[model samples]
Target: MFSKACEYAIRSLIYVTEKSKNGERVSVTDISTAVESPFAFTGKTLQKLVKQDIISSAKGPNGGFYITEEQAKANRLADVVSLIDGNAVFQGCGLGLKICKENQPCPLHQNFKEIRKQLKKMLQSTTVAELAESQATQKTFLNNINRN
Candidate 1:
C-alpha cells in the first residue's frame, strides 16, 4: 500500500496527464477537483513532485502545472512513486518481518516475492502519457479522484 501523499501524487498525475498536452496547463483547483484530492495535501505533493521534476508548474495569472514533451514521454508511475514515497512501499518485507532476508526468508516470501515483482513491473512500466492515452474516451480514474 501507498501513503496518502503517494496516492495524491498519482491522482494529481492523472489530472495533469488528462488536462495538459505537453504545453497546456490548469490551476491547482482544477487538479484538485479532477483528482478528488485535498487542496493543501495535494498541493504539497505537487510541490515535491515539481522539485523532483516528476511534474512541472508555473506561477502568475496564466501560469499553472504542465509537462514537457520529454517529460510527457519519460515520466513513469515508478518515478512518481519514488518521488513521493521513495522505495518504502516496494522495498519493505511482504511478511512484515522485523528484518527478513534471503538467508532468513519470511513466511510469505515465496508467495509474495513474485507478486511484488509483478506489481513493480506494472507500476514502473506504465507511463503517465500511456495511461492518459488509454483513458482518452472513458472515465479518467486517476484524474477523477475528486467526487465533484
Candidate 2:
C-alpha cells in the first residue's frame, strides 16, 4: 500500500540503522542496491529523509547516511510514512472515492477503515531500532539474496 519511494525509504532506514549500530555510514549506492531500488530514486528519498531529520548525512570522503541512536529510538515507521506520503495513507478512500466517510461509506469503506487502523497502529508501534535489530540478527532479509 506504500508508494515506491516510501518502500525504499523504509528499506533504506532499516538497512542504515543496522549498519549504524556498528558506527558505520552507508552510501546511497549501497542503500539502493541493498533495498533493490534505483539509485536515483533512492538518492531522492534519502535526501527527503535527511531534510526531514528522519535520517542524517555528512559530506566528504567519509560522509554518508547514518541514523543517530536518538533518531532510531525516537522515530517510528509512522513518522517516515507521514513525512514521505503525508496523511494520505490514513485519509484516502479505499475505492478511490473523492469523499468517502462513515456517514457516506463506500463499498469497501468499512473493511478498508479497519485495515488502515491496524496499519497505523503497527506503524506507530514499530521503531527503526527494532527492525534494524531484526535484520542484524538475520531474522529478516533485506534483499532476495541473504547477506548474512
Candidate 3:
C-alpha cells in the first residue's frame, strides 16, 4: 500500500542500517542489488533520506551510506512513510475520492479508517533498529527470493 519509492526507501534503509550496525557502509550499487531496486532510484531515495537526516553518507575511500545508532533508534517506519508518501496513507480516502470525510464518507471509508489506524500504530511503533535486527538475525527477509 506504499508507493514504489517508499518501498525502496524502506528496504534500502533497512539494508544500510543492518550493515551499519555491523560497522560497514554500503554502496548504492550494492544496496540496489541487495534490495532489488534500480540503482539510480535507490541512489535518489538515499539522497532524500540523507537530506532529511534519516540516514548519513560519507565520501571517497571507505565511504558510503550508513545509519548511526542514534538515528536508528530515533527513526520509525512511520517517519520514512511520512517523508516519502506524506500523511496521505493515514488520512486519504480509501476509494481515492477527492473529498471524503466522516460526514461524506466513501464506500470503504469506515473500514479503511480502522485499517489505517492500525497501520499507523504499527508503523509508528516499529523502529528502524528493530527491522535491522530482524534482518540481521534472518528472522525476516527483505526480498522475495528463496534463500533455501
Candidate 4:
C-alpha cells in the first residue's frame, strides 16, 4: 500500500538502525544493496530521510547515515510514511478516488475504514528499533532471499 520510495525508506531506515546499534554508519550504496533498491533512488530516498531528520548523516570520507538511540526508539514507521507519502494512506479513499469521503462513500470505503484505522495504529505503534532488532536476530527479513 506504500509507494516504492516509502518502501525503500522503511527498509533502508531499518537497515541503518540495525547497523547503528553496533555503532556503524552506512553508505547509500551499502543500503541500496542490502535493501535491493536502485542506487540513485535509494540515495534520493535517504536524502529525504536525512532532510526530515528521521535519520542523520555526515559529510566526510567516513560520513554516512546513522540513527541515534533516541531516534531509533522514538521514530515510528508512521513518521516515514507521513514524510514520504503524507496521510493519504490513512485519510484517502480506499479505491483511489479523488473525491471520496464519508458522506459520499466509495464502494469499499466502509469496509476499508477499519482496515486503515488498524494500519495507522500499527504503523504508529511500531518503532524502528523493534524492526531493526527483528532483522538483526533473523526474526524477520526485509529483502527477498533466494533459496536456490
Candidate 5:
C-alpha cells in the first residue's frame, strides 16, 4: 500500500524529530543502524529531505542530520510523502478500473473515495513533530513493504 522508501523517509524523519529536543545530530551510519535500513540508499533519501528543507543536516565530525524545532513545525506529513513518492498517492482512483470517476463509478469507488479524501486531508494536516511524539511514547514498530 506504500513505498518502502516513503515509509523509511517518514520513519527516519520521526526519529530525527524525537531526537531533536535533545539536539541529537546523528550520523548516517547511526541513523541507519538505529532505523534498521540500508545505509547508502537511506542516506540518499535523507540528503533529499535535507535539500528540500523537510529536515536539517550538517557535515563532518559532531555534525550530521537533526531536525530543528522550527523544522518540526514546518514539515507536514504530506510534504515528506510527496517528496518521496511523488503525486501518485493523492491522484490515483482507488478502484481497480482506470476510468472510475464521478460519471463512471466502480463498486469500490464509493467505498474508497471518501477514505482516500480523508487520508489525504489527514496526511496534509499532520506533521512529524505531532506524529513523533505519539509514536515515540507508544510501542511502535516499523513495517516493511514489498519493493518493486
Candidate 6:
C-alpha cells in the first residue's frame, strides 16, 4: 500500500500526463478533481513532484503543470514511489517490526519479502507513459466515477 501522498502523486501525475501528452497544461484544480484528491493536498503533492523533477510547472495566465515527452517516456511508477515514499514499501518490515530482517525474521518476513520483490518489479516495469496511454485508450479509469 502507498501513503496518501504517494497515491495522490501517482494519480495526479497520470492525469497530468494524459492531458499533457497532447501539449496541454493541467491546472491544480483540474488535476485535483480528475484525481479525486483535495485541492490543497494535491497542490502540495504537485509541488513536491515538481521539486523532484518528476513533473514541470510554470506560473502565469497560461501556466500550469505539464510533463515533457522525455520525462513521460523516462519516468516509472517506481521512480515516483521512491521520490514520494522512499524505499519504505520495498524495505520496511511487513509486520511493522522495529528491526525485522532476514537474519532476525518476523512472522511475515519471508512471505512479505517475496511479495515486495514482485511489487518492485511491477512498479519498475510500469512507466507513466504506459499508464497515460492506457487511460487515453479507455483501458483504465483514474477516478471511480462513471464517466457516462
Estimate TM-scores for all models: 0.87, 0.96, 0.97, 0.95, 0.86, 0.95
Clashing pairs in 6: none
Whole-model lDDT values for every prediction: 0.78, 0.93, 0.95, 0.93, 0.81, 0.92
Better of 2 and 4 by TM-score: 2
Q: Give a tens-digit lDDT track for model 4, residues 5-72.
A: 99999999999999999889999989999999999999999999889888999989989999999989
Ranking by TM-score: 3, 2, 6, 4, 1, 5
Number of the top candidate by lDDT?
3
Candidate 1 matches the true fold with a TM-score of: 0.87
Q: Is candidate 1 or candidate 5 better by TM-score?
A: 1
lDDT (10s digit) by residue, model 3, range 1-148: 8999999999999999999988999999999999999999999999999999999999999999999999999999999999999999999999899999989999999999999999999999999999999988888999867456
Instruction: Estimate the lDDT of model 5.
Output: 0.81
Q: What is candidate 5's CA lDDT for residue 145?
A: 26
Worst 10 residues of 5 by lDDT: 139-148
What TM-score would candidate 6 get against the native? 0.95
The residue-by-residue lDDT of candidate 1 on 26-73, one tens digit each, is 878888877788888878888888898877998998899987766767
lDDT of 6 at 19: 95
Q: Better model by lDDT, 4 or 5? A: 4
Q: Pick the candidate with the highest TM-score.
A: 3
Error of 2 at 59 (Å): 0.4
Q: Which stretches of candidate 2 lie over 4 Å from their true place?
A: none
List, residue by residue over 8-127, the lDDT tens digit for candidate 6: 999999999989988899899999998899999999999988998889998999899999978888999999999889999999999888999879999999999999999999999999
Candidate 5 residue 27 Cα shift, in angstroms, is 1.3
Q: How well does model 4 score by local distance difference test?
A: 0.93
